[model samples]
Target: MLTERFRFLLNRFRDRLWVKPLAVCLLSIAVAFVAKFADGTGMAKFTPQISLDSIEALLSIMASSMLVIATFSVSSMVSAYASAANTATPRSFILVVSDDASQNALSTFVGAFIFSIVAITAVKNEYFEKAGLFILFVLTVFIFGLVVVTFVRWVDRIARLGRMGTTIEKVEHATAAALRRRLNAPNLCGVPVRSNLEGLAVYAANVGYVQYIDMAALQIWAEQSKVRVVVAALPGSFAAPNNILAYVIADSAERTDIDSTAVALAFQIGGARLFDDDPRFGLVVLSEIAGRALSPAVNDPGTAICVVGTLVRLFTLWSEPEPVGGKQAPKYDRVEVPELSARDMFDDAFTAIARDGAGVVEVAVRLQKALGALAASGNADLREAAEYHSRLAFKRSQNALSISEDLEAVAKAGNFKTKHAESVSSSDGKQQ
Candidate 1:
């Protein structure tokens, strides 16, 4: 719960524009203070041999150059976000937009510019004329060096930020990470909430995707009230006044005066679902990209195949065992949540791809193989989903393919048994 809370906070912090630059400026100011205070100290002996005029010139040039670079970078980033939404998937725009590298790059540039202005102003005003000259000079050199290094790194990172392959990889990695976490804690580390239990229905005041649930807070409330809280809708569910957000179960009299507002506040509703807690959303976004690539206008089957492989990798992890944690029991014993269904994940991931790529033999083949591989994972749920999708894809491929050879090839792969094996199996069954 604490980890989740921290993750939630960290995620929120990372999405903002001010935090990084603000911190950078604060650090710059601190350095300036250090330089100012070190003025009269013998530490000036270590200061590099540099003229104040040269330092001012360097700072002035950096401040002006960095401003232009920052502006260009922002524009470039905007274009990339637009291209990603149009070419790849709109859901991916968020990841690309919140990219740490891009944000850090921009922040560094802006921060550097601010640092330069402050230092230049201080130098021109004679604030460090007689004292702290060495400290100021040294710090200015360091800042300039940092700016150059950051600019180089930023240039490299910006080039790949919103490209289709990069976007797909980003989505896949995010989804895989989320899936791994879910594999360890399917119910978000809460007690499994029962579906059949009837309790007091709690309604959400707004209509939007449930972005986050403060489970720790909810658990505290449940413990304090001595009642079981069944979360009817988990994060990523669309909630409105009409929807039941949760159910409060009690043994005796109902606590009518207790405001459900606090319970409502626990859920953070947003305009759209995010990939952080919703692995399904990520898978869905990946499928959307494949669907786009397979469109007649694009005809990029290779990308679709690549996406199929990525999905296979994810589901393979899904079939693994829940990672055991430490001896400490889950903190939210009273709160219940449902497990994400493997079938639904399969549906969200492959159903559209199967529908869109039906005519493409290569895609069909790879999809069948991916499903077949998943079927072999031995998790009954995954096996069932794989079998279901394999048959559906097979039927579509049968209709889509005009060539008998391609149809036969796809069917062979889908069956998990080639013609020879099928004949041998028939003979064995008959003999038995």
Candidate 2:
């Protein structure tokens, strides 16, 4: 099985771009060998009395040049392939199979070996009179090749680092914006209008009051009144304006109360409640409602002002306060949570399975911890909001555990079943 696996891997590798460099190296060797044989056998040797020693020396030089080129090509190809593969696939597999430093060193050694052979052959052929000159030439080639390789690798590293920094900045900005929106409860005035009912739902959820508004009541109201009471917004959501998010029965007697209540409910839940009837009053009412809810916690107009001030500060800084509230009043600090790419997450699960064996308690525990942290810090409310998200996380973890066990079972079964069948077939054939 191992031999077959190795053969499969070798075939796959031979199809990669680096294989071209390997082919070139082999071709160079073959050409040099054929030329030497042709000259020896008097097969159209159109040379001006080329000596055997001189011919050998030229072959050595060509071989050295080919080796250097091959080494550089292999190093570049391996680095590019590994980086690209890591981006697309799992880092765990890449870590298991290859590393940048080792690949680089191997390439350099191969090139150095070829250079050494050339140096020895050149010295033997008396290409230079002084031994020092030969030594200098060898040293020069080695140093030059090493420097060039190192520089390329360094540039590649820097470029990757730059990309990582930019990604981190973007994540920080998004997190900060989200935190600010949550904290400040900014009045959505002159904002591009989107769906109002959806906006109301989100606002309700964010302010920990969405459950108060009966969904059934709203639905009943919509049907009885012959008005489309569309939810322009949901709880924990954002919107922009002239966007008719919700439409209600504008002609009904209860229309005034329904729209008023809807806007009032939306304002109560950290949303800007603006209407054609009274836009500024809507803003004042929303502010008063949010302030009254938060006032219990901070208990002062100054503190309320501070909370609003914090939102602006967070927005400008593009950051949030750390979980561990520090002294000197919690200041916003940029946070960069490493985004677990699909490959990274898969690799984490793979590594856990491979090292700890299947059905391990640790895997479940780790996953639980991860989910818990996400719940605690990820703008999620366990009591009145985010029940759906919590349930989804639980289901996902359960599924992952099940999948891990299945994979383990399959791996344990292996190709032994195939071998056993083959053995039975042979035994029957012999009996016949």
Candidate 3:
């Protein structure tokens, strides 16, 4: 559990600009010390024959040029992020900003630059003896090699980083991973969370999204107080003053205020919802992107179609059976939380696309086919949701299209169970 906590903290820190560069600089300095001690310790004999002055010149050039390059890289990334926000959905900007590859590449470049500056300063100070000099020279060459590799990789990644298709793929991957995590530990591996509770309702003190719920702490308090706790709001849910954040259920004889504050502290309320615990947010973002693409100014029906395919992939994944057998018992069995609804996810994924792209015959046809395919996924809830959206999209297409042929095409593709009866009624009205 401590390991998991440490892992969570490390992951949270890893995406930041300072963490990796600081780590790389410290490690480089540690190597410099190793080189200092190993200078005349038969290590220099095995080291390369590069001269100190040559190494210092290279380091100086790298230090100056790399600072410029790093600044330019940051600027380019900022431009790309702005473009992505404008072209794609702004909700996905966080993922682009926190890109692991981009962060790593930038860190490597900046870290190498810092190492160069420090090495150059040390060399000018005559801190390194000839043997130590040879070691630093070798490390400098290694750093150069690292810089070249990182630059090549960064170039490739930056070219595609903020493109609409690439961003969609990135969001989809993040969403799928989040969904898998939820699939494994729905309700945070606790009993099913319920909305109803007879216990004392604990309201939030702030207005924000419930970013994370620390079930471990809740279970601890529940265990200590000899009561069952029911979470009223899960992660991604908005919380407000006097809103029930959770319900504290205690025995009739027990006092209520014992650990209520501590329990409240466990919920990590934040300004925005996180993508990790909120699959619905991901779906909404994808739908928003599709809606943007379908706008008259954009008119990119292909993107909407791609998003439809992605949604189908997501729902198919959702339909898979969750893996069985955890190594330990459920961590917070006494805490009850609600399961995510397939219906909500579907609406988030499709409703906007259907409404916005309704006029485009190609988009409408693809939407029908995509929904029909999802309806065949063998999950009853998914089928029902898909059919419902299909009918709504069909009706929207009917209203948006002025041409009779386009309307008929979308109606034909609807594939609703009542299609025959509707067609018959329409024929009767036309004949009258």
lDDT winner: 1
Which has the higher TM-score value, candidate number 2 or candidate number 3?
3
- By lDDT rank, best first, the candidates go 1, 3, 2
lDDT of each: 0.82, 0.35, 0.81
Residue pairs in collision within model 1: 39-132
Q: What is the Cα root-mean-square deviation between model 3 and the actual structure?
A: 2.6
Backbone clashes (count) for model 1:
1
| Model 1 poorest ten-residue lDDT run | 321-330
TM-score, per-candidate, Cα-based: 0.91, 0.25, 0.92
Looking at model 3, report the run of 10 residues with the lowest lDDT sum. Answer: 321-330
Could you tally the backbone clashes for each prediction?
1, 30, 3
Model 2 regions more than 4 Å off: 1-98, 131-134, 137-361, 378-389, 393-432
Candidate 1 local lDDT, 221-285, one digit each (tens): 88877777788887788999899998887645565555566688899899899877888998999
Alpha-carbon RMSD to native, per candidate: 4.5, 25.8, 2.6
**lDDT value for model 3:** 0.81
lDDT of 1 at 423: 46
Among all candidates shown, the one with the greatest TM-score: 3
